[model samples]
Target: MLVRGKADRASRPNLLGDLDIPSGLSASVGISEFTYRKGQEVYSENDPAEYVYQVRKGAVRRYKLLSDGRRQIGAFHLSGDIFGLENALVHRLSAEAVVETSVRLFKRQSLENGAETDANVFHRLLSMTTKNLRHAEDHMLLLGRKSSVEKVAAFLLEMDGRLTSAGLLSLPMGRRDIADYLGLTLETVSRAVNQLQREAVLKFIGKTHREIVILDRLRLSSFDIPG
Candidate 1:
């Protein structure tokens, strides 16, 4: 069963409104809000795709486990990002909170029902799916063809655009999480970051390794392989 709770006014702006889903649809179809602690599982792979989620605060990591006990992270969803809209009835990847997180959940069945009666809802659903597809395609390119340096550079640029504040890119996940997402080992990711720092491309801040400042945007961009 979907847990029910009130979504504060502060979090209203981060809901389905960004996807252009009618506000009326949320109340009429029933929306649930869930709060998860850091490293907690939001949902597991092959679980029923009962709800679509929008991050209200913090970050989420979507990943898959291999038969041989290895793991591959697909993406990290940040605040205001929607995820878990699978094409089938089950989620292919498991999602977990990278930090203490709150998310607004929409019943997938209710959403599908709304799409049947509303053209706008249908269009928005299609648009969201297309956006996910494009991201997957880009990730595939990065995993399949991009060099180690290029992959790390692209990752930094992505986080810079998504999470940078006051000139610092505060990454919510650690090196191991980043390595899984980029299909590289932890040592390789560390070396790549160190190389970039050595070249004055970026600088680390504070004691935690999660915060960084991009000193040369153009130099960073040079390392990204064009698709």
Candidate 2:
């Protein structure tokens, strides 16, 4: 299914939007509250996933756990995005709210039942899944082929597009998380970031290492490989 653009008139309303779903459909969905302190687990792998979540605020990370305690973070879900969709039996990857966060949730059974009866809603869900898959595929290519600087540049560009505000971009995750996401070591991430700073691609802000100002948007876009 073709995903609708945010500015398109035909765009569907997100959970945070004002579009009114049918009462029957809306009744199947209800909000739930969850909180995770930094490094806390929201849900473990193989846990029964009774619901799928939409981020109301903050961020979440989904990752796979190896038997030897190695972890590969698959993706991060930020505000206005959805996550926690899983098979009927159990969750394949573990999810954790990246900070103190709250999410709006709908029961898995309810979502399935709603989907069975509502083609439009089902299409919307599938479209969301498709968008996620596309990002994962693009990230896989970045991980496999991109240089460390290129990867970091691509990551910054992505975050800039998705979350920048008034010339400043605030990273929701830490350097270690960024390293894992980019398939680089933390030192590598630091070096690439410092390089970007020295090159006037971005400006560092604050001592906490969360805020950055983009100095050259066009140059940053050039780092991403053509999709």
Candidate 3:
């Protein structure tokens, strides 16, 4: 998605909201810029966690690999979201850019060192890690327990909130990725999407099927499984 000025700013959800970072910590850290094209791997599973990344533009996906090369996408990171915050020095999951994305990366060692000296930064990092864990837990429940239709509805709501701009929501990932994430087959994912469009809950921009327009949020939520 192309963005300009304030419109671009709104696309990102701030990770640093009300979180205090020591002034000294800011001066000690430096950021490197990296741009990734669609479907580019940011870092692979088992790679050394050298940096913590903050998205300056676009989205990312973090996923786990099974024994047979199947991947289950754990989360989708939108603008202003942080990824590559590892629980250890090595990454547990692989991360990839969903589009032409730019990220500001800071050395993990520097952050760790700064955190030792700054209580606020330490607390913020701990809190962020907990939040990521919680999100992963929630996604696991959704994937394991939700029906195919419910899964699609949940996915729509999430994408709508994250990527929609000017009342249009465009998905960067393909059907195979969506199926793997939702724990459904590709045909099932396509069928659910078609059903939603027919039911007037959503509409597509064109034959491409990438651009989605949600027509009725209330109806969409009604399809969500019992909490």
Candidate 4:
């Protein structure tokens, strides 16, 4: 990873919100910047976990390859999200930039040092780890029990809250990424999305139709998707 220098807090607010790093603890820990191109590998599985990362811009996808050549996306880390907080010495899953992305990185050892001094830092690290584990458990349940339409709906609801900006819900990742993340076929994801469009629950905007706008959130919340 190349260091692109550091950013001041004024330039990037919530630079370390995920860990809720205290000002004192954070001041002692230096942060550096790194940028990755779209589809660029951030880090591969088993790579040394020297640093913890926070998305400064764009998004990231973490996934694993199955035996039959299928890819299962475990999570999507959007702007202001912190990832790569690992207890193990190596990354458990591989991560890639969903777009041309910039990240702020701080050494894991520095964080460990901070945790040793501050009770708040230690509890914050433990809390973040627990949250990650809970999310993984929820995702596993979604994959094991939900139908394709249900999965797609859940995914849309998630992005509706996370990615909506200026009345436009722009998705950084495409259908294939969504398919892998939702554990559904690409065709199935498309069909479910189309069904939602037809029912007036959502619609794509602009000539490129890359942006989404949720129209009837009530119906979307309560509607029964046709199987």
Clashes in model 1: which pairs? none
Q: Which ten residues in a row have the lowest lDDT in candidate 2?
A: 1-10
Candidate 1 C-alpha lDDT tens digits along 96-161: 999888887878888898788778888989888998999998888788745788899998998999
For all candidates in order, the CA lDDT equals 0.87, 0.75, 0.80, 0.83
Report, for all candidates in order, the number of backbone clashes: 0, 0, 0, 0
Q: Over all chains combined, what TM-score does candidate 4 have?
A: 0.89
**True-vs-predicted CA distance for residue 91, candidate 4, Å:** 0.5
What digit string (tens of lDDT, one per residue) describes model 2 on residues 160-194? Answer: 88889888899889988888787788999999898
Report the C-alpha displacement of residue 146, candidate 1, in angstroms. Answer: 4.2
Better structure of 1 and 4 per lDDT: 1
Q: lDDT by residue for model 3 over 61-143, one digit each (tens)?
A: 88898889787888888877888988788999899988788876777887788678878878988988998999888787678
Off by over 4 Å in 4: 1-9, 14-28, 223-227
Which ten-residue region of model 3 has the weakest summed lDDT? 1-10
Question: If ranked by lDDT, best first, what sequence of candidates would result?
Answer: 1, 4, 3, 2
Q: Which regions in candidate 2 have their CA more than 4 angstroms from the true location?
A: 1-21
Q: Model 4: how far is 123 from its true place, Å? A: 1.9
Root-mean-square deviation (CA) per prediction: 2.3, 6.7, 4.2, 2.7
Candidate 1 vs 4: which has more TM-score: 1
Q: Global CA lDDT of candidate 3, please?
A: 0.80
- For model 3, the superposed segments whose C-alpha errors exceed 4 Å read 1-19
Clashing pairs in 3: none
